[model samples]
Target: MKESVSYAPSRADFTGSPAVAASSASDGPSVKSLVAVTLGNGLEIYDFAVYSFFSVIIGHLFFPASNDYVSLLLAVATFGVGFIMRPLGSMVLGNYADRHGRKAAMTLIMGLMSLGVLMVAFAPTYKDVGIFAPIVLIAGRLLQGFSAGGEVGAATTWLMEAGGHSRRGVRVSWQMTSQGGAALLGAAMGAGLSHLLSDQQLYDWGWRVPFIFGLLIMPVGLYIRRQLPETHSTTAASTVANPALTLWREHRRALVLGILLVMKGTTTFYIIVYYMPAYMVNTLHMPASISYWISLTAALLTLLIPFWGGRLADRLPKRKPILIGCAIVSFLLIWPIFATILYGVPLGYTIALIAVDQILANISAVAMFLLVLETFPKAVRACGMAMVYAVGVSLFGGFAQFNVTWLLKVTNAPMAPAWYLMFCSVVSLAALVAWRERHHDE
Candidate 1:
């Protein structure tokens, strides 16, 4: 008779003792784990930022048109196309992460992101392949959208769970910090390339350099992510069941509120930070290099402020800082800040205003992410966060630049983006207030 095989959970299969898990999680993540997870996030953001900063040049190469404005609009539209795939990516990958292990999901998405970056990096321009060029570009952007859809949820959850309940605010802050770093790096690259290359040279070939550089970093990101410890091990068995349905049935309220809250962050980020350089160049007629540098400065401030905001979230009521940040954005600063940029203020003044705007934005972002991290249980945390964030970004963040451009063109109002930002802030503030009250009752 053949010996019967028996299956048993291994040590790695177990989520760790409750006491041990709690102790380790609250104590904060080791530098190794933090760096490993965040590196992938940075890579993802770097790819997106590179695309945004170079959209004008890319427009000429991929979607040449008789009219310059139309060509640029097409390129921006292509950029938004990637966002369209985000919700679907979120559903599939988010569900996978919730069902499988965070480590496995994270590793897989990094590889997917790498493939997308490679597609864009190597795609032939319209001159080389005619219609196929734009096709290739759109395909790559869709792949990236899919990969990114699930990235934030998996990464943020990993950081939060690893950080423990107590220090989750500080721990998850790295998610935004990594993004800010990517923005800074992307801006610096654009600025350097703009300075070194003639306009024709940049349009012809220089734009592809950043995409290639992003591909080179993929292996490093993958290797680092593979070494990360799993945080959702506690839900290993339970997660095998469908999490998406569970999330909708049980956490629908949280999901809706989460999306609303995320709208403000995504809009503010895309508009103020990512879109600033383009706005300066296209609308304000600033030198591309100077615009890139100004954006780099704001990105640097954005990177620094989050750590402080995270620390404050740890010490104070998370909602207070968030509310204050929203108030400042909605009621006081948005109009004047945009006015400064629109009216052709001195470069130093514009940069200073941008820095202050980013600081307030970062504070609200840190508080919001921390709140979301704490709201969901581990079993469906990754899926829940991914779905909400992806949807919010798809609707608001993805189209931010497109909307701003359209608004400016149709209305011929320089303050169009500012009004949009203020509107989003007000909506988000209402959602935050509701969320705070709901959690208080619970």
Candidate 2:
């Protein structure tokens, strides 16, 4: 394993001359640049997770339905609305990144994302603004959806391109790592605030605090991104005319498989990580603070597992790890784990079950991301990735929470989430098999 690990060659190693190497070393991607490229993704996911975490309170303020369940459903539905705009954002901004540059598209995306955060953070409540309150919230989510549509493709492609082929898995894993970090941070904030504030206080104004914090850091993300060196060169971009059309005509099979691949990861992610807090509080009748802390712990584990998985990918056949991981999740983990949680176990037991599930799920997730990155050509990589990601996440991920909630309600079954996870795992595994054969032929 140690022998297989590849490091990026330094300027000194490449140049042979000491003085030239010293001067050129500063030109490569610095630690600051890597952080800058990933910062927007981290912050974008933080905003989205925070909204989900506080959905119960947000429903009261924005939707205000007579029945609490209806209000909560409406809030989650609005959250899904943001995903609907992601495909459009992918087409518009993803094409711009492919044709113009990743840096330019990223900058514009952050600006639009910040505007959406501001609207959500300070929008008038339903009581104060009547029907317009929900309208404003929807507009904000649409803007965010648009921004997020392009974020994954641009950021991941830039990281892979900048790191070169040797450590592509390590580089691409950082995108998901950043998202895990955001989930951790959001969970921590919710935990801390829930401890400090009363239910009335949390519902009234505490829910807005996380969004406000996100808004404050928006400028810093923008400044950092501005300093990033362009990974795709001008000459290469000029050679590709109509990259989107080319992707559609030439890479249609890759696109379909990409969507299926993304479905398992995104659905599992939303249910285990994003929806855990709600599941604990609403279903298990756990305290809000305790639920947040459990989620926070699982999130911390999620952040660490991907890097380990990426290292394994660099050392082994990527497809094998993905298949093994998916098998564990679908066959071994899902039903028994959810049953353990539903049977009213100790808090420690519940946390352990969740942590194990997340670790297995993330291992496959990092491998899938690296596979997608390798599947597309560099010229249209960003657009192709964005389109597939946006479409898959919109269709499955956007409705993940809503579907779970609805299923639980209709069936009155604690194991409903497990069934959903099982179905996604099967679909994704089939997609992985298809991609492996197709890639072999190519």
Q: What TM-score should be assigned to candidate 2? A: 0.86
**Whole-model lDDT values for every prediction:** 0.76, 0.76
The CA root-mean-square deviation of candidate 2, after full C-alpha superposition on the true structure, stands at: 5.3
- Displacement of the residue 83 alpha carbon in candidate 1, Å: 0.3
Clash counts per candidate, in order, are 3, 0
What would the per-residue lDDT of candidate 1 be over residues 333-436, giving only the tens digit for each residue? 77877887777777788777767777777777777776776677667788888998999998998888778989999999878998998888888777777774
Q: Residue 24 of candidate 2: its Cα lDDT?
A: 51
In model 1, the runs with Cα more than 4 Å from the true position are 1-26, 198-205, 234-237, 280-293, 317-321, 324-330, 342-349, 437-442
Q: Scored by Cα lDDT, where does model 2 land?
A: 0.76
Stretches of candidate 2 off by over 4 Å are 1-28, 198-204, 236-239, 280-294, 317-330, 344-350, 437-442
Candidate no. 1 TM-score: 0.86
- How well does candidate 1 score on lDDT at residue 117? 88
Instruction: Specify the poorest-scoring 10-residue window by lDDT in model 1.
Output: 1-10
